[model samples]
Each structure stands twice: as structure tokens, then as C-alpha cells.
Target: MKIERTQTGVRMEKRLLKVLKALAEHQDRTLGDLLEGIVLHAFEGRAAFGDETLQVIRQLKAVYGLELTARDSHRLEEAGDDR
Candidate 1:
């Protein structure tokens, strides 16, 4: 397989890093490979969600008494509009 290099940075908790490292070792793959797979999968299907879909998620969160910070709520709203 051919390998390419790119520069990027992400901030994650130490525990999460440990988990990722364990998974990568168990799978005998590089951490970069695993993360690329995850990110690609997340972007594979739709460009954006419609208003109805966004509303449903918000309603479900509310019904379950789940609270998102103002910033998180705004980010979700923005994600639905991102294409």
C-alpha cells in the first residue's frame, strides 16, 4: 500500500488517546489509518440534514432531558446546514 503524509492536529483527552492506541495496536494499524477511516465514514452519505431531521434530534434530546450547552446547540445547528 502507498502512504501519503498530511499535517493536522486534534485535541483529545488522555484516556481517549490511550483507548485509540490500544485499538490501533490490537488491529495492527496505525492510529492515522483508523482515524481517517472514521472521518471518511462520517462524511460518506449525506451532504446535510434537513430541518425536520434537525428538529427530531432536538426534540428527542429535550424529551430525554438531555441538555447541550449553547455553543454545542449552535454547532449542531450549523452542522445541519453544512454541505
Candidate 2:
């Protein structure tokens, strides 16, 4: 099925967006396409990706300097006030 998509702006961490863009290019897909797939899978109570994709994600995570651990799941304040 073809779904129409609308362009929208969203605020996100700069490095995170960089990683997502790289991942999209690595997978030969668009950022919107990848995010839609991930979100839809989550809504269905399923893993968004399999082992292979996870590996690719890990590589991208490392390249993007994202050293997130299982215990890092929590809200983090900005490093410093930009203003």
C-alpha cells in the first residue's frame, strides 16, 4: 500500500540525526522510511530490527560516538544552557 507522507520539522539531538541519516544511507533507504518502519514495529509490540540490523545499528552508534548502555535509559538535561 502506498501512503502519502507530509514533510514536518522535528527537534532532535544533532549527532543523533547524523547517525540516523548515515543509517538510512547505509540501508539504502530514506530517514523517514526507516523511522516509519521502526515506529510501526514498536506499535505492534515487536522488535524493529533483527540481529543483522542491530549490528549495523551498533556500528553506526559507535561511529556517531553514541556509547549508550542499557543503564542509560533516562532523561538527561542539556550539558549547559546554550542561551
Candidate 3:
């Protein structure tokens, strides 16, 4: 097997770590590769959550009796609409 190495560290909750490990194993990827992809995606300014995602978050907030700021509401509305 080829060995790839990099120096980096990120702290995640233990439960999140377990889930990541399981997903990596299921996909036949090393944890490092899985994490690298995620980091790269975020660095590339990809939306980790899109329209449906924002809707879900808004729904959850509503269910918990939370209110969004005007800016947040505008952002969510923008996210919902196709540009």
C-alpha cells in the first residue's frame, strides 16, 4: 500500500470521530482522505448545505421556537430561490 502523509490536526467530538471512521471504512477510504476531501470542499467555498439544507435548518429552528435575524431570513430566502 502506498503511504501518504500530512501534518494537520482537528479536534472533533468522539462520537463524530466514530461516525467518520465508520463512513471511511464503509467507503474503503482512509480517515485522512475522507477528512481531506471535506476540508478541500469547505476551502473551495462549496456550500456544505444548500436550499433543502437551509429549509431543514429553518424548520428545526422553528420547532425549537427560535427566530432568525432579518439578514438570516433574507439569506435563507435567497438560498431557497434558484438564481
Candidate 4:
């Protein structure tokens, strides 16, 4: 089966976007495919991926430079800044 896709323009939080792209690469999938699967799973009230995927995401985050820890994110938000 083949699916047709249209390119769409969108804006998002930079860090979030970076993480998503990294995750896509980590899973050996295209960004669009990964996002589609995630959105569709969410629509069905299911988890997008499992613990194994999360472990890969953690490793890929470092590889792709998406290393913003939760604490770091909180500190940035508290300071009203982006890093």
C-alpha cells in the first residue's frame, strides 16, 4: 500500500522539533512517517512507542544534540529564556 503526502508549513517549539527529528532518525524512519504514527496512535489513545524506543531516543538525543534535560528546560523557562 502507498500513502500520499502533502508538504505543509508549520511552526513549533525549536527544541521540541529538534527532538522529534532526532527521534525519527533514531527509529530509522522519516520525520513525517514518525510524526504520523505518533499522531495516529495518540488519536487512538495508545502509546506511540515502547520502552525500547525510549532507550533509543535517549541515545539519539545525545547524538543529535537534543540534550536539554528536564531540569535545564525548567530553569530556562523560569528565566524566560531559550538555550
Candidate 5:
């Protein structure tokens, strides 16, 4: 199936973005493509990556210093936000 894509500004944490970009490069995919696949999988309540891919993600996270986890979802505050 062919899907149309749109360009928009999306803000993300610096280290997490670095890890995501590196992972996309490692898998020879565009960052947008990777994010689309991950979101599609999540929509279906499916796991986006297998053990090997997860291992790669772990390494990338370590290299980029992205320590955020699922538990941190919905709890993130902007860098300058004091609330």
C-alpha cells in the first residue's frame, strides 16, 4: 500500500533523537520511515522490534546516553519548564 507523507516540525529530546537517527541509519532506512513503522506497529499493539533489533537499540541508546524508558512516557518536561 502506498501512503502519503507530510513534513512537519516534531520536537524530541536530543539524545533520544540521536539514537533514533543512528538506528535508522544502521537499518538502512530513513528516520521518517522508521518512525512510521514503529507507530504503525504500536497502533496494532504489536512489538516493533525483535531481540536482535532490541540489542542494537540498547547499544545505540548507550552510545547516545538515552536513558529514558517506557515508564517515563507522559512524564517528560521541556528543558526549561519548571513545572
Candidate 6:
């Protein structure tokens, strides 16, 4: 099936972006491709990465110092927020 794609300007946490980029490189896919797969899986309520891929993601997260977890979603504060 053919799907239409669009360019988006989305903001994300710095360390998380580094981990994602590294993971995409490790998997030999473009960052946007990787993101699309992840989002599609999430929409289906399925796990995106299997054990081996998850292990690689863990290593990437460690290397990039991504401390945020699912629990932190939607609760992040900007770096210079005075509130």
C-alpha cells in the first residue's frame, strides 16, 4: 500500500532525540522512517521493539543520557521555564 507522507517540525527532548538518531542509524533506516514505524505500532497498541531491539535502545539511551521514561511524558518543562 502506498501512504502519503509530510514534513513536520516537531520538538522533542534533546537526549531522547540523540538516542533516536543513534537507534535509526543502528537499524540502517532514516530517522523519519523509524519514527513512522514506532508511531504506527503505538497506534495499534503494540510493542514496537522486540527484545534485541530493546536492548539496543537501552544501550543507546545510556550512551545519550536519556533519563526520561514513559512516566515523564507530557510533564516535561522547558529548560528556562520560570513557572
Q: Top TM-score: which candidate number?
A: 5
Tens digits of lDDT, candidate 6, 1-83:
99898999999899999999999999999999999999999999999999999999999988988889999997999999988
Model 6, global lDDT: 0.94
Cα misplacement distance, residue 30 of candidate 2 (Å): 0.4
Model 2 agreement with the true structure over 1-83: per-residue lDDT tens digits: 98899999987666678888998898999999999998999899999888998898888888889875546546544679564
Please report how far candidate 4 places residue 82 from its true position, in Å. 17
2 versus 6: better lDDT goes to: 6
lDDT of 1 by residue, 1-83 (tens): 69788978876544445655555565587998867765776698643335774565455555545565536643544334555
How many residue pairs clash in all the candidates, one count each? 0, 0, 0, 0, 0, 0
Q: Score each candidate by Cα lDDT.
A: 0.59, 0.83, 0.62, 0.78, 0.95, 0.94
TM-score of each: 0.47, 0.81, 0.46, 0.66, 0.95, 0.93
Worst 10 residues of 5 by lDDT: 1-10
Q: What range of 10 consecutive residues in model 6 has the weakest lDDT sum?
A: 58-67
lDDT of 5 by residue, 1-83 (tens): 88798998999999999999999999999999999999999999999999999999999999988899999989999989988
**TM-score of decoy 1:** 0.47
Model 3 residue 28 lDDT?
86
Q: Against the correct fold, how does model 2 do in TM-score?
A: 0.81
The lDDT of model 5 is 0.95
Give the Cα RMSD of candidate 2: 2.5
